[model samples]
Structures are given as structure tokens and as C-alpha cells.
Target chain A: MNKQLVNIKNVTIGYQSKKVLDSVNMQVNKTDFIGVIGPNGGGKTTLIKSILGLIPIWEGSIDVNIRKSKIGYLPQFNPFDKAFPISVEEVILSGLSGKKHLFKRVNKTDKEHTEVLMKQAGIIHLRSKAIGQLSGGQIQRTLLCRALISKPELLILDEPSTFVDSQFEGELFEWLAELNKQIAIIMVSHDIGTISSHVKTIACVNGHLHYHKSNKITAEQLAHYECPIQIITHGEVPHQVLATHKH
Target chain B: MDFFKGIFEYTFINHALIASLFSSVICGILGSYIVSKRMVFISGGITHASFGGIGMAFYLGLPPFVGAAVFAVLSAFGIEWISKKGNVRNDSSIGILWSLGMAIGIIFIYITPGFTPNLMSYLFGSILTVSTGELVFMGILALVIALFFILFYHPILFVSFDENFAKAQKAPVRLINYSLMLLIALGIVINIRVAGIILVMSMLTLPQNTANLFSNNFKQIILYSILISFAGTMAGLAGSFWLGIPSGASIIFTLTLIFFMGKVLKILIERLKRKQKQFLPVK
Candidate 1:
């Protein structure tokens, strides 16, 4: 492994008094692509939240080698107020909030950087359009631009392909694959088949972390790791292990 | 022309006009956050809760504004604290404080000696009666709000839009939230003089809604809100003066009219565009 990006040791997270995640340990390296898979209520999102410092850990610690701003996050699609008057350019520019001083206004260089990122994300055409008026694919691309504009060392995505169509979903994963050349990525998802092809390793999260060294996990391995999720693959199905389901 | 000339000659009219302009500008800037964050009900709670302080001041024979300020700030912080610390939803806390403040105000007013002071002006504002000192205070508040927005636009925008993302970026989300709540409280208190507790929320939201019809940028909305709100306030003032009615109700009604007008115009323009597109030949 290269430089360690995040080291979560025996972390526990919960809301109220019920323990949602308990004693979860995971290590992320600089060039790692980890796909976190689990059941619906299996602490997958909680683990990501703990890594991003969005929720308080009850038992252990999550230490990050990178600065806070150096960790980029693309959260799940929570519907926004349709009447809010914000443009795509302004939304992307706000990604630099952590990089700049509190009172500092965005300057010419910042605008140029935003423009570059917009072009790379293929959202330059929608830059001046209202965010509410954009299609789902455009909004997803815009959010991706906002996450990448700061040039973070680690990118965490929580179900990045939820609202995305299949065409854009492939493109989104391709972009992430390209981005993984430089930084680390931790993607949490319930969809295992599509994620298996993109990630370098797999981690089964069900209140605890089970690190699988390879992307391909057999049905026996799934039972061994105690991960209850069923993997369903499409197309010619080159992989045979996925077809070895006992259920 | 005669009515306009008669109104311009009075110093009170000048004070009312200036106060109206200043308050409208302040509301335009901060109201964007209130609307975007969906905290209009919380603001409404603070506005009414401040009335508790007003009643306490009446009972204790103190300056009503000072008492209202103290109570408004406390209730604002209190709402935040209870919602965060206790096993209560935010709307529940807002509901608690909203009625608690009103009850406290009524009790204090009932206990106070002598006939109750004419609170009609406070309940339904009399902008023509606004004094020079009040106008100056409004002006200072407008400046403070403008400076705050100018300096912290990025973080405020990020936090308001996506607090989780802002937290990951270490954008001081809690500090921004607290400060905004404080500003909202202060804004409600000051605006009570121009638009009473009953009608003040409209002052905060209607102009922003009207502005949304024209622009989809946050900064542009603020600019348009200020212009639209100022226009509405001026028209309301004139209407109130000519019709011999209360200024607060008139201002709110005028803004409502503007909101409907903007909605109708937008629908008409969209229909026209659709018609034009249908008539054009296929490529």
C-alpha cells in the first residue's frame, strides 16, 4: 500500500442509544478503490459517515492523514428545493469553501479552475443554467464537478449512481476509474454486480468491516464473511463464482 | 400630485421612507437564507416569542424593544439548543416556544397596572410613525448584514445548500448556523417596528419569491429582492397613506400582489414561447 489515507480503528456509531455500527476497522491507501457493500440497514452509510467525520464515533477513532478539505465527498441525491435560485457555476464555486479564507471572495483563478473542472465533467454547457432546471444527469455531473473542483486526495461517494441513467452511470464510473489513478476512493452501494467490475477490493459492512482482498467474492466467501447481500450480474456473465449461489 | 407633495413635506414621512428602504434591503439579503434553509416557521416563532419580552417590559415598565431583544435572542438560541440536545424535533421546539412566548406576553400585559398601552401600532405597525433614531438603527443593521454576507458568502452558500458536505470540508457549519439564527432573531425584532409580528414573515419571503421568478443565482436573487421589496414597500406606503389604513398590513398585501403578478407573468411568457416554438418549421 502507498501512503495511508484513512485508518478507522474499532469505531462505533449510533443514533440515540441503539448501536448502528460496532467495532468497525478499515484502512484506505492512497491508490485504493474500495466498494463497500452490505444489506439495507447494514451500517454501510454509517461507516462512510464515520470516515468523513459527519457523525460522532462512540467507541474508537477515525484518523485521517489528509486535511479535511483534502477529502472530497459526493453524497446521495437528496432532493433540493426546486425554487432555490442557484446556478451551476455558483454551486461548483462553493466547493472551494474549505480551501479559501472565511471572508475571501472567489477570484479570477477560482473561476478559471471551476471552468476547467466543468469542461472535464462535461457540464460547461449547463454552467449558467439554473440547477433546478437541469436534468438528472446534468445535476449528477454538476455535483461530481463540485466534489472534484477542490482537487482532493480522497473521494468518498455514497451511492453516486442512484439517480443516474445506465449511459451516464457507465460514464460516471469511468470518470471515477480515471480519478482513482491519483487519489483513493471509498464508494458505498447496495448494487454489487456493477460495482464488482470497477473496484479494486471489496469490504462487506454489516455493523463490522470484513475486508475482501479481491473484487470477486464467491457465495461461500459471502457466507464466510457473514454478508447477507446477494450479487446479481448481467450480460454474458464472464464470472462463474457469481453463478454459484446456493439460494 | 397633491397627495405626494403633502407627504414629502413631513419629516415623519421622510423617516418612514428611509426606514422602509433600509429594512427592505436587510430583509432581502438575509431572507434568502431563511427561504433556502426552509426556516420560515422558525423565524415566525422568534418573531412571536419576542413579544413575550415586549409584555415583560410592559409589566416591568422598561423599554419594550430592549426586553424584546433579550427574549428574542434567548428564544432563538433556546430553539436551537432544545432541538439539538433534547429528544424533540425542531418543529416541536418551535411550536413550544411559539405559544410559550405568546402566553407570557398576554399574562404580563394583563398584570400590568393601568390601561394597556395601545399595542395596535406594535401588532400592526405604523410605518409613518417610525422615528429618526429607529431609522438610523435599521440603517446600521442593514450595513452589518451586507458585510456579513459579502465576507462569508461561500461558506454560507455551501452550508445552507448541503450541510453534510460542508462538514466534510470543515466549513464551521455550527458557527454559521448559530450566527444565522442570531441574525434572524435580531432581524425579526427590528422589523417588528415596520411590519408587525403578524405580517413580518411575508416581508421576509414574498420578495424572495418574486425575485426567484427572474433569476436563478443567489446573489442576483438578493439584488432583485432588494429592488422588488423596496418597490413594494414604497407602493404600500403610498397606498396606506392615500387610503387611510395601517402601513404594516398594506406592505404585506402589496408584496402578495407582486408575488401573484410575477407568477401570472411567468406563466404567460412560457405559454407564448411554447406557441412560438409550435409555429416554427422542423429542422
Candidate 2:
């Protein structure tokens, strides 16, 4: 039996007395690939933030079995000062900083490991380049390498493909699929059809959470959970699946 | 060169030069963080808030630096607190404290009975009149900054770059942030004697921006900023000596000039690289 990685029970999350998520429960196993989908303000990010302990719970409990460093998080791309004077290699090498001593510098082993991860991510050539000079795809790839460098058992990615082009987005999903084989994954994205093919389970978070056992979630089921977004499916029909009005 | 040799013989000139070196080193190291973290506004707030302390010191017949340090540290923590716990936005809080401190300084200076000391020096610096005590204070601060950067280089980098990741790593993110704010406050307080209240913000930003044009490595930026800051200070000091102008204004002008030159140079190099690429045979 696979070990339980996260057991979130009867949890409620909010900000300043306003509740964003209520009565959310989830169980993540050792090898589970969970795709979290919902409309923009439907508490998907709030749920993930609660799990990462970035937000405080108003009620109930969330117990993460793994240590903090064992869980890697890749936040959505936000534009910080690009000319802030940091190299791609240094940015990725910072991933191992959690494991090293606070007072110690990045040791030789850290550099070697960063090198290996850079090579794997196909960014070894851009290792010495400034982060400001990198393309969007290169920055995303560099961030992914940073996220994976510490060998996290559970990786949490927030809209990992929002900044990349479609070609690189496909490759990123493929890379995440490969990484999922060894580690549990929680990917939060608005692209439903894209994640449906990759994740083992589907979680719809809209104030409350609706957990589907498989990735194939129907429009009726999504509406039953009160999630308002339309899911577009590929194939012969290629039609938008809309929720039927009950009233 | 002859001007420097002639000035180097005087004891007060030597003190001024040493003070400039120490201030440049600390500013280079701490300035990198301030610029990268975009805390220039906070530094400015602290610099202005320190004026209150200087006024209080004048009113009470105490050393101005002591009053400035106390008020600066309090305002630094106050700004952090107000932004985090209260409803005031960070920038709004900064603006409030900035003007309030200056107002208090003006009031206290007005109330003092004796003939008011030359406030112009404090307002725009009198580097030529730097005392040994101020030099010692800056020296200690420079040493402290160097040790902090050396010992906690990676952790501080992680904290500065991606704070969420640092928190996940269980790094003391809050401690680092608060400590850095305090350091910025102290740094601004000590630097007041060099660039004074009006021009110290440039001292904290220009060298870092100039170094950023050449390299992005944090260590390289610090080293380069220190060198650049020292060179600018020397040149400005000499300029002020020859022109009979205020050292603080001259120093800031020199640094700003360097910043523009660096920008132009970067554009030229980019254009040159494009020309080279275009001239090459088609692949």
C-alpha cells in the first residue's frame, strides 16, 4: 500500500473573516497525480495554499506527512525585477539551499547536482546567462529545474503553463507526466482538457471540493459540484461541454 | 593625482577618505539587497524619519547620530508593523512617516533656544568635517554587514529571490526580513553624514544599478558596486574640493552621471552585437 502523503480533513480556509474554501477534505497518496481545476476565485489556489500552510485554516485540520523540504512548490510566474542581477545557474542552485546549512555557501556537491538538473532540463548552455535574458520557455524550464532539484516527493505546481507557448506547454506537461511517475503531483490549472489526460484524479474546488476518482469528469458532475467553467474536450466532436441549467 | 597626493597629507582629509571607503563598502553590500528587493522607498522613509532623531538630539543637547539611529530603527519597524498589521498600505505609511518626521525635526529645531547650528551640513552633508567617531561607527557597521553576507549568503539569496520557497525550506523568512529592514535603517542612519538626508537614496541605488549592467551574479554586483561607489566618492570629493561645492551633492551627481553612462554603453554594446550578427554569413 502506498503511504498517505496528505490528509486534509474538514478544512475551511479564509482571509480576514471571509471564507474562500469550506469543508474541504482530501487524501493524497505516495504516487497520486491530482489535477485541481475550478474557476478563478473558486478557492483552488486557496485550497493549495491551505495545504502548503501558506494560509491559515479557519476550521478543521490539514496534516502533511512529509517534511517541508520534501514538498516543492512552483508558484505562478509573476514579473519581478528581471534585471535584479541573478544568473540562471544561481537561481536553480538556490533550490538546494533548503538542505544546506544556513551559514554555509553552496558547496561543490550542490553545484554538481545543479549541473545535472540543468543538463536534464536542456538549460545547461544557458547556465551562465542572466535570468533577464532568458526566453519565457527558458525561464519556465529553469523554474521547473529549481522546483525539482531538491528531489521533492510531492511537487505542487500552480498554473505551470500560463506563461509558455503551446509547443512548450505540451512538452512541460509531458515532463510533468514523467516526473509524476516517481513523485506525487498536484497541478493547479484552468485548462481542464489538458490536465484530464495527465492526472490520475480530478479535484474540483469551488468553496467546497468535489473529488472524482478518475480524470474523466462530466459536465453534469462538475455542475453538481457547482463549478461554472466550461470544459472543452478534444476528438471528433470537439465541442464545449456546458453545464445544463436546472432552474 | 597631484590633488589627491596634496589632500592625502592632511589628517581631516585622511579621515574623510577612510569614512568614504567604509561607507562605500557597507552601501555596496546592503545597497544590493535594497535595490534587488525594491526597498529603495523604505530606505528613503527611514532616511527622512531619522531627521526627527537629529532634531530631538539638538533639542536635548545630545549627539545627533544617536537620536537619528533610534528614530530610524523605530520608524523602520513601525513601517513594517503598520503595513503588515494595520490597514495602511506600505507606500502610504511610508509617505506619512516621511513627512511627519521632517515636520517634527523642523519644530524641534525651531524650539531650541541657542543659535541654531548650521543645518545645511546635516541636510546636504559635510564630508570634510567627518569625525573619527563617525568613522568608527561606519567601520563597525561595514564589518557587521560583511559577516552577515558571508555567513548567510545562500539563505539570504533564497529569501530575497523567492520567499515562498525559502519558507518551504523552513528558512527563517520573517527573521531575515525584519533583520534586513533593521540593517537598512542603520545603514541609512550612518550614511547620512556622507550623502546627508537628501541624497543618500542615490548612494544606495546607483552603484547597484551600474554593476547590474555588467553582471547578474550577486557577489559580483557587490564587488563591482563597492569599486564603483569608491571611485565615484573619490572623484566627487575631489570635485567638491576643487569647485568649493557641497560634497554630498557632488557625490550624488557623479553617481548619477555614471548610471547614465552605463546605460548608454549597454545600448552601444547591444547595437554592436546586432551589427556583428547581421554581418555574419547566412547560416
Tell me, by TM-score, which candidate is best.
1
TM-score of chain A of 2: 0.89
- Tens-digit lDDT track for model 1 on B1-283? 6557866798888888888889888899988888877888998899899889999999999988888889999999998888778889999899989999999999999899898775777788778778777778888889889988888887888778877677778888889889988888888888999998888899999999898887778898899899989999999988888898888998999999999999999999999999999999998
Q: For candidate 2, what is the DockQ?
A: 0.52
Q: Pick the candidate with the highest DockQ.
A: 1
User: DockQ numbers for every candidate?
Assistant: 0.60, 0.52
Clashing pairs in 1: none
lDDT per residue for candidate 2 within A160-246, as digits (tens), equals 887678877777778888888888999998888788888999888888787877787666666576665465565443334444433
Model 1 residue runs over 4 Å out of place are A226-230, A234-247
What Cα-based lDDT does every candidate model obtain? 0.84, 0.85
Q: Give the Cα-based TM-score of candidate 1 against the true structure.
A: 0.94
CAPRI class of candidate 2 = medium
